[model samples]
Target chain A: MQLFLLILLGIGVLILQSAFPFYLKVAGVKPDLLTAILTLYAFIEGPLPGARLGFIYGLMEDILLGRFLGLNTFCRTLNSYLVGYAGQWLNPENPWAPTLLAFISVWLHYLFLLLPGRLAGFRYPLLPGIVNIIFPTALYTSSLTLILFILLRGGVSWKRGRRKAGE
Target chain B: MFPRRRYSLFLWMLLGGLALFLMGATGWRRDSLGFLEIAFREGLAPVQKVVATVGSRAYGWIEGLKSWRGLQEENRALKRELERLQALNIQLEEHRLENQRLKELLHFAETQGSDFRFVAARVIGRNPTNWYSTLTLDKGERQGIKRGQVVITSKGLVGRVVKVSPNTAEVLLITDRECAVGGLILENRTPGVVEGSPEFKGYLQMIHIPKEAPAEENQRVITSGLGGVFPKGIPIGVIVRIVTEPDGLMKKAIIAPFVDFDRLEEVLVII
Candidate 1:
């Protein structure tokens, strides 16, 4: 049931990302909500489940974008797993956890996503891609992570309260 | 329960293998739509459309609220603009009719063809990433949209359809790095291939034009009809500047595209 709900949330975030303009985009780069969610989920749930969620969400994103098919899947799954492993030594409840982890995850995600295209002889200006796209996207995703973390945490407490009231 | 480190390694290897397999499969095939992908995208279209509509309405409401105080002034300005446009429209119509009559005479003398058949569609969504410029249109194969069909606005050429589902199609905008168009300079008739410039936003570049070709700044470029992908004579852009490569044999020209991609709302696809 938790997995199902997370999947639904992933879909909703994907739709929102697709349908609307980002509130804080620089150089036409927007925050990646999927990366933020995957990172947060990994921090909360640990490596295996987080990797699974990442794989599913990444696959859906890849299909929806209809560009490179497996690129997101490969990058996101690895990112989630690494975050999950890191989570074991860190506290998820820390306010900075999602922010810092999101920054790292987004950086890794772009590295993985762009490296293959660059290697394929696609001419992405390396310095500009990093400065304009990767760094800005990482900062944007981290900012979004703060908001999403609060919302998810609030949702959990709310659900727990309802369960207590019923009891 | 945490798996053993070796077990985790095995899982990583397994998923890595799967990712490579998918990459290989997708790379081996140039088609974006397989049967399953078509079904998936078709199924997702309604959801995308609904979300887009609701989001747009919400955005409009917010914008309208913010500007409510100036509504009367805005309305008056719009009315004045409409009247001015109406006067210009009358003059343009006369010119159009004269051009059509001249074209008819040319057709009788030279066997010129009719205008292209097109299907109009609304822009539904845009690319989620900044790396590419793609737009999803509400029309698809059901409305005669097909892969490789050229999309255009009233102003000029937009892009080409890259993927089609039952109800939605994805257009690869000409500004994206991957897109290339065969172009002809309106002044000198120099033929070249215009491709999206990676370094510049909202700009295109035509490369490999002969250095001796009299391609000047502000010259108009149009489709050359060399490639069957786009129709002949679609207005592309105007050359902004000529670039001399390190090697002197060929030259590049910077172009400002005719269609404003950022403000695109609707497009007509040449079926």
Candidate 2:
């Protein structure tokens, strides 16, 4: 059942990614949907399941972008695992709580990818990108999460109703 | 079975990293990758078609609302420019030399028993989340574009044909991490490799020129055409900053790319 849920999560992510670029085009900005989804799922599931989902998500992205094939996978898996580990200390039940953690984790995820590239004497203008894009993105993503929280609340109740009727 | 999932995750990542390092180190570029690239293009073609169709319809409606006078003026300008190119064709060899010359040669190159003609392709995909600039063009094998063919703009060398499909190609811009152009400092006459500094801010870094090579600020860099991939003397960019090695035996510099990526409406592919 755990593996089944994980697979379902991945399928959901692929559909999201497939549909995301269009949404980005409409909005004129690329929101890191994978990052948002992975962070959210990592908080829901434990680190292990989260890492598995992250790996699958990353592979699909790397395939679609045709980039350094596994780079996205490695980076995303690392980010999701870190977020999952952090979830241990947070109250996922609180509506506002996971939003703060997601905000922090996304920044950490970007930082993890940036460090090795920077250490190689490549100057990544971290401050400006974070200041300009990251904060706005976090607020946007938080608003999105709030909307999602309300939506998912409905979805969870609907699922429970179907399950109880069948049982 | 203790933290078994963690162990597998670590193992998978390690193996995956090894695979990526191998691929990068070997520098494997293939025409078949064009299949993947073209699939992306075709997959997105409908979206672009819809956009272009809607954009043109809206434009046409606006044209009717605005005036026919503006359209007539643009037509006159294009005709005048066309005549000027015909005249320039008679006296060339000095300005836009590389593009004209390449096209002249392309008019003669074999392997296409039918002459390989040039066409301008629309810029579709710009590399997302990238400092290194790459562009995907919407023309491909159906147009007789092949591996190792050079792509250029009116200003100069854009990139080479790394991958091509029946309808599209992904151009590894002169600014890609693995793209190397045989280049020289026109003033100093020193030869070097212009490697894409992916981490560089929308530019390329020409690396490993000898210390004796005096590449100063604003020196014009052009392809030496040492390699058959890019024809010689195509303008690349002007040097912006020079990085010197500790021993001072060699030096390199960053080049501000001449191609205005944002406004890349059309580009002529050299067959």
Candidate 3:
């Protein structure tokens, strides 16, 4: 049931990511909701499950984009696996955990996506791409993750209270 | 423990290998979509279209509310501009007729052929990632929007159709890194290739201009039609700045496009 809910959430995020960014763009960059959600999920779960979900989400994006078929999958899976591994030691209750993880995840995501293309003789200006796109997007995603973390925690506690009352 | 670790390593290796193979297969461009990809895109396009419409309308309402206080003053300014344009329209109409007569004398119609047929499409969604500047249109193969067809607005050039489904098409905006067009400076007739600049957002760079070419700021740029992909004489943008390359071989002009890509709602694809 939780897995089903997460998939629905992924679809909602994908649709909103494409549609609502027209209005929410800052400095020509939009927050990456997928990275934020994946980071949160991986931090709560474990490496194997995180990597599995990452592959699924990344595959959906790749199919929708219809370009660089495996690029997002590889990047996202690696990001999730590493984050999930690191998350085992960190305190998920700390607000900084998910925010920092999201920031780093998005940063690494761009590097993984671009580095291969750059090696293949694609002329992506590395320095400008880092400054103009990668940093802004990471910052935006991290900020969004912070807010989502608080909201999610609040909702979880509320559900817990409701279950306690029923008991 | 040792066996479990080895099994995990094997899984990682398998995932990596599969990813590498898929990447190698697709490369920079995938000329066509697989059946599954087409089916998914077709299935989701309608939902996307409805969401985009509702979102834009809500955005418009919010903007309207925010600017409610200034509407009367804006309306007055618009009225004045409209009156001036109405007077100018008469003069332009006369000049247009004269130009038509001149075109007949020069047999321009035979040389240029008929005007292009256009298929109008509404923007349904944008590229999900910031790495690419692309928009998905509601009309596609069924509407005769083929890959490489030019997309434009009333103001200027937008981009070209790169991917098409039965009910949708994707346009690579002129501001994206991969897009390039042959452009000419209207004032001096200087020809150069305009390419999207990564350093800046919402601007293009006109490259390969001879160092001695008389290109200047605010000069209008138009499609040169050298490339068969785009029609000639379509307005592109105005040069806002010019810079010399490090090697000093050529000059580059920065163009501010007439189309406001952020606000683009509808586009016409040259069919």
Candidate 4:
């Protein structure tokens, strides 16, 4: 049931990413909900399930784009695995952890994504893109991560607490 | 704990290697994954279509809420432009009649005649990646929307259909790095290829302009019909700047596309 819910959540995030507006974009960079979700999930669930979920969600994202197949899968899988392992030492209940993880993971994910593309003879404006595009995107995703984490974790507990109070 | 950690690390490495292999192989063996891609897209397209409808409506509401004052200013400007266009329309009608008579006398065929059949489609989804620009349309093979079909709006050329399923199609936008359109300067008839910029999103560049050719800022660029996909005379963009390529043998011009890709809601696929 938990696996099913996670998959559903991943799909929901993917759909929302598509539906998101350009108005919400900062410096032409939109928040990455998938990265935030995977980061938090990895923090909560640990390495194995996190890696698997990342791979599945990343593959879906790549497939949806219909190009550079498996490119996102590799980055997301690797980032989630690392984040999961790193997160084992940190407390998931710490609200700041997910935001910090999101900021760091976005940078790590883009590096993994860009390195392979560069090796394949693709040219990207590495320094300028990092400064102008990638960094802004990471910040945007991190800010969004805070909200998502609160809703995912805090909202659930609040509901439980309310139910206990009602009883 | 150390052994368990070691096993996890080893497994992650193996998965990483597998992903790298897939990435390397995708370029060479695209056909291997074609079926799976089509199936996934088709399966999800219906839901995307519904979601896009609601989302666009919501976006329209938000835009309407914020743009009332701006719309009033725009309305006045449009009225002024309309009066000017009305005068120009009379002159253009005379020119059109003269051109039609000449074409009839010379027995010239219309370039976009029977050969061009258009399939109208709604923009249903957008690619989540920042690096690439793509749009998913709610029309597909069932509607005669095929791979490589040129997509356009009444305003200008939008893109080309890259992947198609039975009920949906993915259009690689003109701003995407992978897309290239055969283009010509409308004023001088200088031929060039309009390609997307990797460094810049939402802008295109027309490359391989002949050396010493007159390329001017704000010059109209249109489809040259050499691509065999896009029809001739379709407005692409205006040349914003002329810059020499690094090779020194050619020059490139930055183009600002006429169509607002961010607000694109619907498109016509030239079947």
Chain B TM-score for all candidates, comma-separated: 0.58, 0.55, 0.58, 0.57
- In order, the Cα lDDT scores of the candidates are 0.84, 0.71, 0.87, 0.84
Please tell me what DockQ candidate 1 reaches.
Answer: 0.25
Model 2 per-residue lDDT tens digits across residues B23-52: 885576643455676799889999999999
Best prediction by DockQ: 3
Error of 3 at B130 (Å): 0.5
Q: Flag the better candidate by DockQ, 2 or 3.
A: 3
Q: Please name the candidate that would achieve the greatest TM-score relative to the true structure.
A: 3
Please give, for residues B1-271, the per-residue lDDT of candidate 3 as tens digits.
5699899999999999999999888777889988988999999999999999999999999999999879978999999999999989989997887565444423532343378777767788988888888999999898888999999876789999999999999999988889999999999899999888887777899999999999999999999999788899988999999999878989899999988888777777888
The sequence of per-residue lDDT tens digits that candidate 2 reaches over residues A8-94 is 766665555333333442222345656777777887787887788888877877675675677678878887898788888878776
Cα lDDT of model 2 overall? Answer: 0.71
User: Could you give the fnat of all candidates in order?
Assistant: 0.41, 0.00, 0.68, 0.41
Query: Model 2: runs farther than 4 Å from truth?
Result: A1-31, A44-53, A67-71, A74-82, A93-167, B1-117
TM-score of each: 0.66, 0.53, 0.72, 0.68
Q: For candidate 1, write residues B1-271 as lDDT tens digits.
A: 6669989999999999999998888895576668998999999999999999999999999999999879978899999999999999999997897566444434432331257666778788878776778889999989889999988766678999999999999999998888999999998899999988765666899999888999999999999989788888888999998998769899999999998787666677877
Under CAPRI classification, how is model 4 graded? acceptable
Interface RMSD of 4: 2.1
Error of 3 at B161 (Å): 1.0
